[model samples]
Target: MAEQWWRRPVLVDAALAVAVAAAVAIAIQVAGEPIERQADFLAYALGGLMGAVLLLRRRWPLAVLFATVAILLTYYSLDYPGLAPAVPLSAALFSAAVAGRFRWAILVAAAVVVGGLVARVIEFDMATLPVASAVITDAALLVSIVLLGETLRSRRERVEAEADRRVADERLRIAREMHDGLGQTIAAVNVQAGLADDVLDKNPVRAREALQVIRQSTKEALQELKTMLTVLREGSETRQPGIDQLDELLDVARKAGLRVTSMTSGEPRPMSAEVDRTVYRIVQEAVTNTIRHANATTVTVELCYAPDSLIIEVTDNGTNTQQGNTSGFGLTGMAERVSALDGRLAADFLPDGGFRVRAELRT
Candidate 1:
């Protein structure tokens, strides 16, 4: 896998080197002064070296830039032929800039431009106007190449950052799911196990019922856990529990000895997948907390659907040991879910000795 990961870039660099070498040869042949066969061979060899050096650009961008500049300067110093600086130097300058060596690229580019201009003046004794024009054109092209490299570097960084953020978000989502799902299931199982143990010697029938609930809850929890793990490993989408599963959630709570009731008001509207899943998780986490901490016998789950938002309230008629504190992992996960949807969450002890968790989510 590691070898394969590096193969593509190596292949790309090889192709780029070939292209640059070809471009240099074409430029020299088409625009250069006529010379003997031996001199022509030497000129082409030097131009080829400029492109061949690009193979090291990714690992040694500054060195590649320097090598290209030296080769170009040497080519002109020999009075062999005149080739446009853009042909061979552009790739090296762009490579350096993209590798986060913009300063080095800029300095090398300036040196090449000045050196080429001086060589032209000394070799051909060009007029003042022509030299000025050449300088402007070369400077503009070189600057544009550097700017293009910088733009590409910026774009690549932005893309990588976005990808990292998405990975983090997904991990957080899975964590919340594991906490809410497993936590609730285990709480229910604990309640059932206790009931079974108490009734085993007194009422065999009731004890069997509690054990049945435990078996069913564990079965469902294991399946859901398997699905979540599969999604995490394969990066595939799976059907997540939504508000439609409220009945089952309430059933589990009931079997855990809590009188769970749900009430929905206003018109029921469809929600985005994320919103639906979040709503279910919020309710699940709230109920799980009640089961584990509230010591409550009755849980009232209320949903108020409005034109622009949905309000969820889970209230329990039991003592809330933590009172209004939202410090537990369960509450914190709920808050995170609500905040991600641009919503609000409030958890507080009701004045009447019960605890209430309310969340308002935008549709």
Candidate 2:
């Protein structure tokens, strides 16, 4: 996969370094300044090298800034004419501020620019209007660089935060699928296996039928698990079952010795992919629980499409029994999916000895 631009901040920093170096070199050459016995050569090389040091700006912002400032000061003290103070300092100040070293950048700015202004004041007799103007211009330019860097830094931070939130949301969605869809399929397989075990001696024919149900349930579960993994790990598009696949789900329950039926009402118009898939999962989980926990002889899965809403209902006339914890992630996951769509899920145990699951989604 192609790397995101933000993930490669160092590359941008490196390019900035090369640009700064070239700019500094061109400025000195154009100034027609006198070289102080090869001291000018030394100053140019060191000043230009400060730009390349920006490669570590994010890792060592304060150090890079201090190093650039010290090198520029040392270069000027070599007595080279037309040596500008803010030439190399610009890149360093920008790098530091953008690296989130606000305190360090501020401290460096105060120490350098404020100190320069105070020195000019002390030398008032020798400092002309031109000198005062240069000092003010240099200070203003440094502040501008720092301000621009901070602005970009804030934008990058906001981008990163948004990316993190998206990742978290995707994770939650995947978790719900695993719990509601795959978990119920596995549980159904367990139910079939246990039934086969119970009937092995009393009725060999019935035991074989139970084993067949287990095989089919596990096979479907494996396929669904594979799809879930593909979606999460590879980020590849995987097919999600929807209302069209409701008959297949009911077939599995029928084959497992449960009387289950599916029917649709209203002129069935198309639903959004998310809403369609959520409807399937809700019904699937309801059916699985009916067979596993509710000793139901018959269960009904129905879909109703209204002008403004899509409704789904799963009902079973069976005694709701529990071997252990009756509550599971099935209902919670369904609720979460419906809530995401601004819909509602109603799942409850009927007082007359049955269970019902109904979901209503806005069109």
Candidate 3:
């Protein structure tokens, strides 16, 4: 991904400084004013100094603007020429606007506008239509520069907000993944360890199978931990679960004594990686909840893919209630994932002495 525009503050400000200087030099030359006091050179030196100040505009925007305007206004007060006002003043206004201090920027802008108009009135022998048009043009230029800066400021803020939101979402996702994957795997290991201990002498083979399950669960848990760490370091993961993992998921539940079954309908078409992973997570979490809390013997995972949307349902005939699962993001994380994709999640308890977690997902 490309870096944010504001990340390299020096480079951005420097480029802007150079552009402003070039444009101002061109404008001053276009006016064709005589160099009586070497006013053109003075405009160059003074405007160069002003543009140099723009390099630090973001740090002290109002100060930079005030200083630039003060210097320009002083030049106008000396009655040297009219070439020093528009370019430097417009640059200052833009810098202030970009800084997002609208109140301060506007205050400075108002002062600069009034100063520029007064300079125009004093320079002219008479306030004719041409002179009035010049003043209006300067005012328009002032508004336009500040408007551009304000627009950019708003855009930068929006981009930053979106970036912050994405970061928060990703952190939540990693947390939820660890909770679901590691939490369930560890729970399964605990259950199997207990089972192995219970039947160690009478049922040696069964105990060995339980031990095997525990070993596998720990390995899978390690893999899940690795995935989360990879995401933290690289901001991405490759081992995302998909529809293909449903059978293995159900098998794991069966091994954990849940007697889970899975069913799918409609032609399974291609889905985005994110959607696939999220679907698998929802299923995993649902099954894990059933194993840990449902106290039921059977859990069912069903998937129905339509032309437009996909529906997932995980139900258990366990009498274990799920109304007050506020310990962690049990269903809350699933809801966030669903909401991000503009999907719907209904994870309430069923009335028929069972619990159900259902989600309808969209691309």
Better of 2 and 3 by TM-score: 2
**RMSD to true structure for each model, in Å:** 3.2, 3.9, 4.4
**Which ranges of candidate 3 are over 4 A from the true structure?**
1-8, 11-52, 197-207, 226-239, 264-275, 304-311, 322-326, 340-343, 348-352, 361-363
What does candidate 1's lDDT look like per residue over 252-292, in tens digits? 89889999889999999999888999899999999988887
What TM-score, over all chains together, does every model reach? 0.88, 0.81, 0.79
> What's the lDDT of the predicted structure labeled candidate 2?
0.78
Output the number of the TM-score-best candidate: 1
lDDT of each: 0.87, 0.78, 0.79
The best candidate in terms of lDDT: 1
Candidate 2 deviation (Cα RMSD): 3.9
Residues 1-363 of candidate 2: C-alpha lDDT, one tens digit per residue: 999765688778778788778777776666654544333677578757877788888889888899988877666566544445575677788888888987777778777877677656774444578667967787788888888899999999999999999999888787777776676667667777888899899999989988877887888888888878887777636677888888887877787667777788999998888888888888888887787788788999888989999999999997755511367676777788789899988877777878888899998
Residue 300, model 1, lDDT? 98
Scored against the true structure, residue 336 in model 2 reaches a CA lDDT of: 84
lDDT of 3: 0.79
Taking all chains together, the TM-score of candidate 1 against the true structure is 0.88
